[model samples]
Target: MTVHDVTAPDQERDREALMPEAVIDDEMIASMQARAGVNLRIDHSVNNEEATRIAVTKFAGGIGDINPLWTDADRGRASDYGAPVAPPSFVMACFSGIQFGWPGLGSFHCATQARFHQPVYWGDTIAATCTYEGFTGPKPSSFAGRTVTDHFLNTYTNQRGEVVAEINWQVMNFERASARGRSKRDDKKQDLTLPHPWTPEEIERVEMRVLSEKPRGDNPRYWEDVEVGDGLDLLTKGPIGLTDEVAFIAGGGTPIPRLKAHAASLVDYAAHPAWSFRDPVLGSSEPIYAVHYNQAAANAMGVAFQYDVGFQRQCWQVQLLTHWMGDSGWIIDCDAQYRGFVYLSDVVELGGEVLEKVVLDSGEHAVKVKTHARNQRGADVMPGHATIALPTREGASPVTLRARS
Candidate 1:
C-alpha cells in the first residue's frame, strides 16, 4: 500500500523543541554522590547566650512543644538536675550552617533518620561534617518508569571532639516530564492501602488539649487577624536529655540502622569522644566539658542533660512557615546560617513579620515574609525569608494574558 506523509508544521516545530540537556544514567548519579560531603566548623563564641537561646526556642515554637524543662530555669533546676535542661530534640532544632555543594540540584526534598549519641549541653562548641552515603539507580516503577535515591549522613561533635549526634537523610529526584503516565499505578496502590481515619470525638479531644497547651504570648493571632506583615515572636526550646533525643529519633521515620546505634551509645563516654570544658567562655579554643549525657556533669554546668541536634532547627523554621500558612500555602525558598551552639535549658524564640506583597504579572498574588529564630538573650540564630501564595482579596480579577489562544 502506498502512503503519503501529512505532518503539520506546528506539530513538527513542537517535536523539535523538546530537547533535553542530558539523559538519566549511572554516570549522573555517581557524579552527584561523589561530591556530597561538606565540612563545617562551629563558632561558639559570637553571642553564645543569644545563639543558644534562639536555637532552642525556634525548635520548641515550631513543634508546638511547651516542655517546662526547656523554658523554666528554676523549675528545671529543682527537678532531676540542678539546672535548666534542653529538650532532646533541641540538637536537631538548632541550625547548623552547612551548605551542600552540588550542581544542577535545584531544590532539595529531604527525609531524615537521626540518632542521638550524647546530650548536647550549653556552652559547648560543635564541629560537623556530612558525607554522601550512597545512591540508587532508577528502578522500574509506574511513575516515569524509574527513580533515583540520594542518601547523605552527617556527624556532629562537641569542642572535645566527641560525636554527639548522627543523621541520615535521603532525597528522591524525579524526572518531571516522565511523571505524566503514572496516575493509574498510583491510584491502584492507593486502593490497596488501608485507611486509618481519626474519629471526630478523638479529634475534638486532641484539639482541645492543643488549644489549652498553646504557648503564652501577649498578642493572640486569629486566622482572620493575621496580615502579610505580622511578625512571629521567638519560640523557646531545650535543655533536653538523651532520653528526649531518642524519642524524636525513634519517631522520625527512616530505615537506616546507624541512627539507632548512635542513640544507644550516648550512655557511655568510652564508646564516643569525651566531652570537656573550654576557657574564657568564648574563644577559638577546644572544649572541656564532659558528661554530655551524665546527670552530674549537667548539674555542674547549671543545665539539664544533653539536648538535640542543631540542624533540626532548620526543619523547625520550615515547619513554622508551613504551619502558619496552612496546607494550601508552600515554602518556595529558605536558607539559614548557624550562628552559635544551642544547649540544654536554652530558651529559643522564633518571630517574623510580613515584609511585602506583590502581584506578579501572571496574576499570582505572592507574599514576601521575613522570619527569625532567636534565643532568650536576644541573639538571632537563624534569619530567613519565605515566598508564599495566599488567596487574593475577594472579587480580585486575574491577570490578563497577552498571548493568543
Candidate 2:
C-alpha cells in the first residue's frame, strides 16, 4: 500500500511547508498487522480507577446525557442498583485502546462493539488490557485513496478480578493528502459550508424534542411486553456548542500532550512528530486530533470542516439504550457503525426498534434492538444494535458473562 501523495497543487504547496512526514505505507501496515492478536502496552489518556458520582456525571455531561440514573446521586441511591452506575461505555476512561495500528495515517473510528458482564458501581475500580486484533485493507473507499481497517480488543476488569466489560473497536486508516486530492477530483464545487444557521422555528422544534426527552426510569420494561417493531425513546444532541469538543476532552475523552502551551507543546511535537502536526491557522503544533475541532487542521487532514469525534457520537447512541432501559435493566451487548461525518452544529437524533425477543437457556429475558443516529441532513451517520436483559415478571436473574483470563 504505497499511498501516492496527490494533493491539490496550491494546497499541497502550503501544507508541505508545515505538515509532518507521515503516511500509510505498506511497511507500516505490515508491521502493525504482524502484532495482531498480541497483547500490547499502551497508554490511555484517563484511567478512572473508581466510579464516583462526579466521574459519572462528567462523562454523562460530556455526551449531553441528563439522565438522572447517571447524573443524580439521590436518584441513583433510590434506584435498584443502590448507587450511581457509570454508563457502560464509561469504561472508555479506563482504557479506550484506540491508539494502535497505522500510527501516522489519518484515522476514523468506524465501528465499536461492547459486551457488558456486570454493572460498574460507584465504588468499583477498573483495570484494562489491550490487544491488536488485526487489520484488513488497502481497499477501495468512497473517500481517500485506499483504506485499512484495524481491529482492537480491550478487556476491562474490576479490582475483584471480575470481568466487567470487553469492547472491540475498529479504525480505518488512510493517507490524508490522497483524500484531499480525491475530494478535489470528485467535486470541484464542493459546498464548503460553515455552521448551519437554524431558523428560530427550527431551533424551537429541536429544543422542544431535546427538552422533552426522559429516561424510562423506575418503569420496568418487561421483556414479555416488548415486541418486534416497538420503538425506543429518542435521544437528541447538538446544534453542538462551540466548546463541546473541549468539554469532551476535559471529561475524560482522549487527551494529547500537544495541548501543552509554548515550549511544552514544542517538546511534545519534537518528540512525537507522527502524532503531531503544525496548524497553519493557529500557528501552533497540534495533535492529529485537531482535525476533529479545527477547520484548517481538518483541511490538512482531507476533511472539509471540523467533525464530531466518532467515539463521542458512539457514546450518544449508547446513551439512547441506557435511557430506554431502566436502572434494573442491563445492557448485555451494544455495537455501532460510524458511516458518515457529523460536522459541527449537526443535530443527531438517536432511536431504536425492538428486533427480536428471546428467553435464554438460563431463563433470562433478552431483547435485541436495532438503533440508528441520523443527522440534520437525514443521513444515518451511525447505525447500531443492542441486546438488553430485562427483569421478568417471574423474577429472572440478570444477564452475566464469564470472566476472561
Candidate 3:
C-alpha cells in the first residue's frame, strides 16, 4: 500500500483549536507536586492478568519479535526457566502505569529504565501499581522552555507477591503552543503528507533481513565468548502500518482509550476534557492518545505526522538484547530513551554492540551493550544500553536479577 493509505489527508487547523490554552504555571506545577507519593489508579486495560501462552505470543507478535524463548512453548519448556516465559518488557502489558502531564500541555514519554527481578512465567498472574514520584525541571528544552520532567515509579508483581519488574518512567510536559513554535519540521513546508516511497528492492532488503532474524536459542552466549566490539544481528520492524499500531493496542501497550462511542466517550471527555483534543478532520473531540495514530491529532501536537508510541519502540529496543542473549541469559536492566519521532510507514532497524564485560562482585558474569533503533531514513530514534547476565564458560551460576534496592 502507498503512504497515502496510512496517513491522514492534509488539512490545517486554526492555532487556537490545535492546542489547549493551558500554560505550565506555578499553580499547575504545585498541583502536580501535591500528588507525589500517592498511588494513582491505572487507567488502561490490563491485556494479560495471567501470562498465558497466548498473551505472551500476542505481545511477541505485536512487536514483530520471533524469539523462540517467547514464542515457542516447547523451547521455553526445555530451557532453564522450566516453562514458557514472557518477554522481560511484557510487564508493560500488565499495568496502566501513570505519567503526569499537565491537562492542557503536550506530554512526551522521554525515557524508561527497568530492572527485571524475575520472569513472568506462563501461569503467573501479574498485577501492578504506580506512584507519582513528582517532577524535576522547568528546565532548558528544545521543545518548550517551560518543560518539566515528571517521574513515575511502577511496580509489577506476580501472584506470589514477588516483584517482577520496577520501571522508572519519565515524561516531559510542555506547552503545546510553545512546542509548535519551536518545532523543527514544519508540516506545511515538508513533504510529510505521504510516507517515504519505497522501491521493491528496498522493501525486499528489509523483508529479507526481518525473515532472517533468529534467537540464539540453546546456544548460550557465554560471557567469556563475547568481546567488547561484538556486534549483534540486526532486527527490522515496520514500514509501520496502522495494523501494527492496532496489534500493539490489542496487546495493551497504551493507556489511551480509542473509539468508545456516544455517551461513554462523552463522559470520558467531560470528566477529563484536557485529555481530549478537537480533531481537525472529524471536527470532534479525540483522546490525547490519538496523536499516535491520528494525523490531525498529531499535527495538533506539533509533530510533522502521526508517529509510533515511545513505549512500543522502546520495547523493540530491549527485544534486540533478548534475541541476542539466548534463553539462558537474563536481562538485568535496560535504559531506553525515545529521541526521534518515527512516523507512519517508517522502517526501524534495531541493532547493538557489546560495550563492556565484567564479573559482578557476586561472581555473576554480565555484559553491557549499547543499543539503538534507527528508522529507514537512518535517524537514531531510540538509543539505550542494557546490562545482561549470561552463564559463564567455567559454569558459574546465572545471576539472579533483582529490582534496585
**TM-score, prediction 3:** 0.90
- 170-222: candidate 3 lDDT, tens digit per residue: 88888887777666444445545356788889888878888888878788888
Q: What is the clash count for each candidate, in the order shown?
A: 55, 0, 0
lDDT of 2 by residue, 1-405 (tens): 112357777866675323443566778877886788898765534456677777777777877877777777787667766666777888876666455556656788889999888778777888877888888977877787678888888899898888989999888888777787776565456443457778889988999999999888778777778889999999988887658888776666655321466787677667677767777645677777777787667777776668888778878887898789776688888999998788887888999899889887766788999999988878899989988888787784362232111
By lDDT, who's the top model here?
Answer: 3
Instruction: Please list the residue runs of candidate 1 whose C-alpha ends up more than 4 Å from where it truly belongs after superposition.
Output: 1-23, 36-51, 95-111, 180-206, 211-405
Ranking by lDDT: 3, 2, 1
**Weakest ten-residue segment in model 1 by summed lDDT:** 396-405
Q: What are the TM-scores, per candidate, against the unseen true structure? A: 0.39, 0.89, 0.90
The C-alpha RMSD of each candidate to the native structure, in angstroms, is: 25.0, 4.8, 3.8
Q: lDDT (0-100) at residue 275 of candidate 1?
A: 24
**Which candidate leads in TM-score?**
3
Report model 2's TM-score to 2 decimal places.
Answer: 0.89
Looking at model 2, report the run of 10 residues with the lowest lDDT sum.
396-405
Per-residue lDDT of 24 in model 3: 76
With candidate 1 superimposed using the best TM-score fit, by how many Å does residue 197's alpha carbon deviate from the native?
14
